[model samples]
Target: MSEQNQDKHQQRQQKVKQKVDERIAAAQKEQGIFQVITGNGKGKSTSGFGTVARAVGHGMKAAVCQFIKGTWECGERNLLEKAGVEFVIMNTGFTWETQNKESDTVAAQVTWQEAKRMLKDESINLVMLDEITYMITYGYIDLDDVLEAVSSRPAMQSVIITGRGAHRKLTDLADTVSEVRNVKHAFDAGIKAQKGFDY
Candidate 1:
């Protein structure tokens, strides 16, 4: 009975390997990818930072623009800036903290101007637009303007956009889209955000 089970497992493995090999062989093209990470889960921004780390490992230049999060020091911002990544932290804090619509709109516009420059720069290999979805969702910035700038960027420059409630158009334009579903969270259980783990 054991011998029979082993033979069946080997056969299944061989079939799976063949299918995987075929897919690998078919995928021969490479180009800059637009990636979107969004959802209620905690890892949206973290996932974007992972790509920044990947770009750094490859010695590729990267630019990161933080839209609605500033005011306080962020671990990724400090590390990436120290590692020579072009980093911009734009607001005084989240929207709720600022409590000013007009001012927040202005800040969003200014931050996007810098982001647009980074996107267009051919020398930059990757650009991470952190928490940009909120700006779009709240009508702080024009979606068309953002789309125009992004679509006109260098052909080989990758872009990673992370936040909750991503724009539908942005998701459609992205080559890769991932939604981090929340099954459980430490914050929900009354645990505070931990250093180096939550940040």
Candidate 2:
């Protein structure tokens, strides 16, 4: 590249950096953020677990309440649990797989009690509700209860809600919201879900 072109590129990048710096300087809040991860694409729960791992790395206590996974051994479960995260897997499987609403509701309610306890615990800095959207959609857990629990939790305790189809109310209440879009997946192309990559 010509020296003139390189100089122009550097100047452009500097201007962009200045704008970003200004925005960072303008923001002044320090409270814990409420984040919602949802959509048809994968990685919602994966991102939640990533946040849990981040919190643990920062010496912060985290609690994990998995809502719709079965008895399968997940990589995050093993890693987080071994790292001393307060982990709990609530559901036996997806709703269709279970074919038992009554038992599912009972299990969800019991598990939510534990989650609520963790929410109220100020010492726990992060609470990950993995695949919790299904609980609300399936009527196993009330949306109002979830809102109240997170709202009344410690000022510095973050709550991460992960799953598809996050309700508008939940997103509106969140400080940050991200929807992962599904463009393509190997499963749709007659390929099976592989270990580590899919789960």
Top lDDT model: 1
**Per-residue lDDT of 1-199 in model 2, one digit per residue for the tens?**
9999999999999999999999999998888889999999978888888889999999999999988884766888878788999877784877788899999999899889999999999999999988888899889999999999989989999999999999889999999999999998888999987878767
Per-residue alpha-carbon lDDT of model 1 for 8-80, expressed as tens digits? Answer: 9999999999999999999888888899999999899989998999899899999999997677668888798
Which segments of candidate 2 are over 4 A away from where they belong? none
* Candidate-wise lDDT, in order: 0.90, 0.89
Write down the TM-score for model 2: 0.95
Q: Name the weakest run of 10 consecutive residues (lDDT summed) in model 1.
A: 68-77
Checking candidate 1 for backbone clashes, the offending pairs are: none
* Top-scoring candidate (TM-score): 2
Q: How many residue pairs clash in each candidate?
A: 0, 0
Candidate 1 whole-model C-alpha lDDT, 0 to 1: 0.90
